[model samples]
Target: MALAQRLFRTKPTEQIVAEGGHGEGGELRRTMSLWQLTLFSVGATLGTGIFVILGQAVPKAGPAVVLAFVLAAITALFSALSYAELAGSIPVSGSSYSYAYATLGELVAWICGWCLMLEYAVSVAAVSVGWGEYLNSFLEGLFGWSLPAAITHSPGQDGGVVNVTAILIVLLATWLLLRGASESATANAVFVLIKIAVLVFFCVVAFTAFRAGHFSPFAPMGVAGVTAAASQVFFSYIGFDAASTAGEEAKNPKRDLPLAIILSLAIVTIVYVLVAVAAIGAMPWTDFDPERTEASLSYIVNLATGATWPGLIVSFGAVVAIASVVLTVIYGQTRILFAMSRDGLIPHIFQKVNPRHQVPVANTLIVAAFISVLAGLVPLGQLAEATSIGTLFAFAIVNIGVLVLRYRSPDLPRSFRTPLFPATPVLGTIFCVIVMAGLAGVTWLAFGLWMLAGLICYFLYGYSHSRLNTEVPR
Candidate 1:
């Protein structure tokens, strides 16, 4: 009975938020402002997906992929509202993990953190692979030369050795992170500007050749196809929670986190809808080949403009866009690990901040090295589904956490609350599960195995090591 009770004991919210600054090793500097936080979320969420995912998804739903974007955004908004409320109530660095720990229990919190570790690591590695493709394209266009496929492509692909370019980009982001959070945030903002600019430019150019004929078969595959595409494209919005992970760093987390979360989602959704309209309007949906237009937006712009320069520019922007994605995701990853480490759920080394940088250097380095290896050698094209499942699982938990908190601590000072309360969170959870149902069976198998491993690790190490667990007597 004691063990079961211990397993489900909720950590005090005051303790979690209060301890944010007084880490075991050192304090993380609270330097980020509202706009910086907003841009951080934007940079993290808007990646090469808008450039690549549209081609594949468009074929599934036809021009209705625009509706797919809206559906996915609505699904994400449920969880985003939950996150905003929780982050406002308990401003800290752990994102859903911290929220779960406070509202649910130590065991659930450990699982949430573990899932996040997988989500961010796999996400950064996946973006790195896409970055390699665009980097090669940019080089080929400018210098008329590109790296041999053996080094640029992942192992097991056309006699390839390893994706050295992907590993390089991961290392580059790691170096920037070691510089400090404010520095990395600034760099990410610049990259975000470049990506948005390119997308805006594409919309302008592609609309020049827009034809109403593309909308003829708008619902080519019907509502089922739209839902399926929405499920797949939901991964594109995974980083909306990035601001919540930076709670400790935000100058005014309660005010900024919620605004950043909502604003970033609105901005990314608008960009996605416009890009979808432009892409489909410029070319027939039947011609948007996933294999042929790996860089979909760039391909459409090239076809519409009948010029190589525009495509080359789009590719260059993609390269820059992916770099920012890698930066922001890795930033969130390190912060999550930092929170776990500070709570004694993991090694203290992860929480140890560098005196000069005010960042968890060791934690960042460890995460970067692991993801670099994955980017270098693994063929992660099929594993993107795994990333989606992990994210959806996290989203579902955040939604529940909101409901639990409202019941447990109704008076908690939440700067922002989900307006519909029970209904919003309930819908969020249901929508996320619906999306998860669309993933392949193999992905579910892989996620289950991963969670099982996390449970074992928690029982062996996390349960005993956790600060909350230590408070209970043997």
Candidate 2:
């Protein structure tokens, strides 16, 4: 085959679906129901972002931050519809990676997979770093003492060395995933419930102290500010990709994956809007201190009730919430590699599944170890921005994939389709680009380096070993 032919060769849809479960030790077992699938996405997404987003975004958009969340949700809704359509039709472990392979070909599929690596892996590390800070707050609130800053903070920050709690949480998530998908989902459901209840409690308490005046000059910062904040808030909606990634494990993938993706986004947006309203109601947006963002939600609760206990509850909830993100994102990271490995794009180490547990044992552990090191030792302030850009890039490609597949295979069966045909996907791609444009120059530079590295790796190994021309038994 010519070089370009090999690079752009599309994987047959029938073969992609046929090879769904095969791997090194054994095939992945289907144990996830629609509920578990939905919660997994919820657990991955509903993290400390909302707890801190108010402090960070509220100042940017003022009381109209609520509108920012709505705007972000609308942009995500466009991509979510595309995700739903492709997820329902394709239904594989790779999510957008697989979708791209079936439409855009090997190089684009590999690039999409590469972007997911940055999205899931780097976000896991960034969120875990925040976990240590919340753990200290919870400890201090309940016992009047905090973990030593040295052990709790990452290296090069203050007198800190390694973030012990950050590493501990990643290791804990690794152990949970090693157990099995069903077991991990069950534990995530419990964590999700706890975090949701805590947010609800804050809403109830803040409502009593509600002041409508805070929302009077809601557009204090104008449309420009609201648009900027929406770009930041849109990242919080990133984890619904977890639902699409779980396609191979879902019991009724074609029917349930689309539902889970859309349903999870709906639940997250509702929670976000309610909490945004409550936080602003309890305190003036002008008073939101960006310096203490991670404690923003709990800080509002403390000020509202004038008690240490309520704030403590919120802090404790944050610890659980960040830990939940670590678990689910790790699961997502491993599964992406699992799909790539099976396609001969990456090393086979990721392809090895534990036959009895029906999970990628080694893949999970390796990912956890790498993420823990980043969380414990690296200062992730700038590196974390890459997560947003990488995710937006993958989403745009998926939206394009939907447009291509619909044109190429009009007869292909689809469980769900994006409404408005080309408009849906066309807008989805445009929205993704708009968000990507809002990202910082440093983020774009980092993403560029990551993609360069990925392209080099693809040519060095992936192109020669791709399974497009290789026959495998289904």
Candidate 3:
């Protein structure tokens, strides 16, 4: 009973309302509109993962990879619904971390925030590395010059030494974020448009070369292979929930949050499925080589068409798309840390916004430095898988949090309630768990170690430092 009281209890809604109604510390501006919020979600969702994951996923499931993309999209849809409801009920910058705090208590909230570091921070690194490869390709096509293979790749992976291009991209993102959130969002919307155009172009060109025979031996590896490929492809869906994280900034979070989340996911999924169908139709599924998995989709297009211009266009699109990902992911990361610092779960530096720009400068720098090191040194595949495990675990917690909140605060005014209540959230949880189970053992070990480190930091610093522990006068 004592343990339950300690772990499951939360402050009353009255207190939560009082605290949330007023800004924490300084008056941070809420300037984002519905269009900007939607663009943020779209920008974060459509990035390097989709540009390259097909090569790795298609070889596993053949034409069945199309089904895997659909499966992953369905799973993501459930969780997006859950997020929409929670964002409306308790609009806050911390995303799932804030939701867990309101329903599950401070400790779990802290852990969720820690887990989010993997989703945003590590994801930024992984995507930045992807950007490097495309940038290298672009330069090689345009200037006929490329960085030395040793400097362009990560150490201990296929003769890479530094991944200098990845480091450069991360640094650029950090600089952009330090400028201001509103400015970054505007730039992101433009990039999102360009990226969508490029994918549509790919779909058009590839469909021209479509052949019916490519899908004949679909699922040659069977259902298990499809599920495994779905697990891998699931990483492509990570950014759909980014809209929920911007709850504090949205003008009408209740009405707009759900629209952004669902709309972004649906658009991205359609693009993904179309691209997959077109790519498969253009080439035999058996021809996909997983060993060259890091190459941009344009490389495959060039190989299939024997034309260099289409490949160059795709490469250019990839570079811009990845830059947009790094920009938006870093934005999400700073906001999350800002919420944690406001709650006293971490140092105040994360919450310190520059008065001139009203941006979380310290938080951005910290995230950029960590991402720079990871992108500069770590192999892309390892970083990508590890990011997938972390994101799926966070999604599972968010799904469970929705159910908990529905029961715990039944009267909380929600702008959007998940359509099917218990069924939707329950299915969301199960889907996330199944995908998580399919991750490699090494990825799980890395995730376990990261969680352990987070727990230690919470016990050593966050538990006692938490603002929740500080008494508020009646």
What is the TM-score of candidate 3? Answer: 0.93
Question: What TM-score would each prediction reach against the true structure?
Answer: 0.97, 0.97, 0.93
RMSD (Å) of each candidate, 1 decimal: 1.5, 1.7, 2.4
Q: Candidate 1 residues 1-474, lDDT tens each?
A: 388888888889988988985555678999999899999999999988788888789888989999999999998999999988988888899999999999888888899998998899987898897677788899988889988888888899876798888999999899999999899989898999999999999999999999999999789899998988888788888899999999999999999999999999999999999999998899999888878656677788889888888999899888998899999999999999999988888989998888888999889999999999889998876565577788888899999999999998988888998998799999999988988887789999888888898999998888888787777543
lDDT of each: 0.88, 0.90, 0.81
Q: Give residue 471's error in model 3 in angstroms.
A: 1.5
Pairs that collide, model 3: none
lDDT of 2 by residue, 312-371 (tens): 999988998998899899998898899999999998989998998999998898898899
- Weakest 10 consecutive residues, lDDT, candidate 2? 465-474
Q: Give the Å shift of residue 39 in candidate 1.
A: 1.2
Q: Which stretches of candidate 3 lie over 4 Å from their true place?
A: 1-8, 11-25, 156-161, 377-384, 472-474
As a whole number from 0 to 100, the lDDT of residue 252 in candidate 3 is 77
